[model samples]
Target chain A: DQQVKQNSPSLSVQEGRISILNCDYTNSMFDYFLWYKKYPAEGPTFLISISSIKDKNEDGRFTVFLNKSAKHLSLHIVPSQPGDSAVYFCAASALPNYGQNFVFGPGTRLSVLP
Target chain B: DVKVTQSSRYLVKRTGEKVFLECVQDMDHENMFWYRQDPGLGLRLIYFSYDVKMKEKGDIPEGYSVSREKKERFSLILESASTNQTSMYLCASIPGQGASGANVLTFGAGSRLTVL
Candidate 1:
């Protein structure tokens, strides 16, 4: 069973527009949510994250919102640029973890067109 | 400069052949992980090491084994490769220092393996 899921397989947005990527999880125990972006041949890099205590976290143009009651989280990228186009993965883990509770979604491929 | 490094970028081997994928980290972090990426399945952990000579099995550990004899290296061993085992393998590490960075992974440029 998939503990975390990205319902959208892909998304397309115009440059300078806002891009939103969503994710859901079955495990309510997950307290932390993270977003990672991956390029074609490169490894994934951390983008942003949100703690359950806070409903939202923003880093520059990127913002992550978590709805603990809904067991859902979303990533928002404002003024989506070509550089922001990549496979974005939503990951979660129950804290006090050494790696066991961690789970990642299938990922959403975002394409930004100029 | 890459903090985490996977030795091979691509590899192909016959069925039943022994395969080994190596990972190294220069960050000197205490924890390292091995994960496989498959279409629609996302990243599934195969194994993880917290300290030298100490390892733990993750969600998917079958058909895989690992070695972490030293702090900077972790090796994943496939005793007998199978076609179903073909996928992209990634190595990652966390700071393990505090809650803020513990769950964040710094991954290596993955190794794509094909078993035929």
Candidate 2:
């Protein structure tokens, strides 16, 4: 069973619009959440993260909101640009494990068209 | 800046052949992980090491093994390469403790293996 799930396989948005990628987890033990972005033939780069203690965290145009009660998290990118097109992965892990077992979602491919 | 380097970017091998994928991290982080990413299946952990000479099996350890001979290197080995084992392998490292409470992982570019 997949502990972390990205329901959408792909998403598309127009330039200068907003792009929202959603992720949900079945395990309540996950207390730390993160988002990573990857381009073709490249490694994933950490984009943003939010601890369970807070509901939201923002980094420049990228914003991550956590809904602990629902066990869901969403990443929002405002003014989405064409360069934002890539696969986004959602990961979660328990802090005490010290990043030993990070559960990653299947990933959502985002395309920002101009 | 922390960087994880996977020596082989791509490789091709015949069935029953032994394969080795090497990874090294310059950050000297205590935790190192080997994961394989497949289409639709996502990143499945194969093994992880928390300390030199110590290793732990992750979700998918079947037909795979790992080695951590030193603090900076982690190696993933395929005893007998099979067609089903063909996938992209990614290596990552993270510190044991952090001020932010959440440790971030630095990833290598990844190694794609093809078992014929």
DockQ top scorer: 2
lDDT tens per residue, model 2, A1-114: 889999999999999999999999999999999999988877889999999999999999999999999999999999899999999999999877577778999999999999
TM-score of each: 0.96, 0.97
Residue A10 of model 2, lDDT score: 98
Give one digit per residue, the lDDT tens place, for model 1 in A1-114: 889999999999999999999999999889988899999878889899888999999999999999999999999999899999899999998887665567999999999999
Per-prediction interface RMSD in Å? 1.4, 1.3
Looking at model 2 chain A, report the run of 10 residues with the lowest lDDT sum. Answer: A93-102
RMSD of each: 1.4, 1.3
- Best-performing candidate as measured by TM-score: 2
| Position A70, candidate 1: lDDT | 91
lDDT for predicted candidate 2 compared with the true structure: 0.93
Backbone clashes (count) for model 1: 0
Model 2 CA lDDT for position B77: 97
- Candidate 1: tens digits of C-alpha lDDT, residues B1-116: 33998999999999999999999999778899999998888999999999999999998899999999999999999999999999999999876757456767889999999999
